[model samples]
Target: MLFRSLKPLLAGEQHLQLIWLALGSVPVVEFAAHANPDALVLDLQHGLWERTTLEAAIGAVGMHVPVIARCAENSHGAISQALDAGAASVLVPLVETAEDARRAISAGRYPPTGKRSAGGVRPLRAGLEAMRAADRDVAIGLMIETVEGVENVEAIAATAGVDYLFIGTGDLALSRGTSDSEVIGRDCERIVRAAAANGLPCGIFTANARAVRQAFESGCRMAVSANDIDLVKEGFLAARKATFEC
Candidate 1:
């Protein structure tokens, strides 16, 4: 499976540069795949993705690059749907407690490990062996964004079956009622430490390449470098400015 390539990043041996896709376009997804990012995240939370597009996008790019679905919520249905759509991993947002972590993790596994029902075109086509492989290879990530989440980071990290802990810095800043970098940095550091102590890789949502570098330096193995929509806008603005200036 293409997702097997991601094992190194998950194992903390290499840094992962994830490109966030919010536009729900297969062409865009394919373009991102050609660019060869470590992973492409289909943002179902804030992105424009319905079931059909999500499945299509995954189908188009899943063979070349691993597609990670950032589920809109931390629920069994949401997690299962993403996996059903052929997402190599599922990122559950707003996870606030150890129970929340467990719930998200459970939604991605099979019986005895999770409650994920056997369905979805990809899994069905792949057959029983694929189902077993999905149970073992499908990565589950929990976002630590709320104040309660930061407070309980250690326990959340300790939760069994958790593949990685991701820090949503934007929401976390709002939860704390302060955008102070130092304060958020402290919380991020704490989360990273907890993940490391538990022998799991940590990931962070970063705004740019510099932030991604900073995140890696702080012990996070994965970082979202940028989203497709923002990159589009930036490209247009830069082109306009360059044309006018010239």
Candidate 2:
């Protein structure tokens, strides 16, 4: 197994991940990509990212990091494109059933098992052995955000090729008509148990001190912190406020 596999082995595993907007000068993205973190993910669901900007950002960060992409959806084209872009793994959003999780895995794997088209200059040119290792180790993370997703967490976790069952707490709360934190924590317990049982890793998003502790205690080895925009905005506001007060 790869070094990235360490995230899933320990109970209450905690990883500090930074989520990037997938565009712009991408200073923050580059910083986090090179940071001494276990893993990081590029968010492409929002319109904030475009292919050109994504290319530039990825180039700036280089390919030394354990980088993964959260595709717009579970579409094969999107997943395949992300892999070509040099993502070591793909996080498929809104996975609600076993089939949904299965499709995401298929999109990540090569032919003979999946329909993913052969491409990507990076992987193709990186040597056949490297590519094969990547294919074997490429993580397929599924976002369980819907009520159906929560309900089928066990089944989805048990699916082959499914590596991480990432609980999208924000959406999970909204779907279940509960507070974000409350719903996330409640559902996290179930998802974590399911993941532990299936010998898979569980992922979660951490915001504050409380959430960080909760996620770790809940068995989420891989955790994503706040996004780039939010962090920048918060940093700017803090600096501006301090200057004005002085």
Q: Which candidate leads in lDDT?
A: 1
Query: Model 1's lDDT to the true fold?
Result: 0.88
lDDT of 1 by residue, 101-183 (tens): 98998888999778999998878888887788767878888899989999999999999999888999989999999999999
Off by over 4 Å in 1: 1-5
TM-score of each: 0.96, 0.87
Q: What does the lDDT come to for candidate 2?
A: 0.73
> Which portions of model 2 show Cα errors greater than 4 Å?
1-24, 127-130
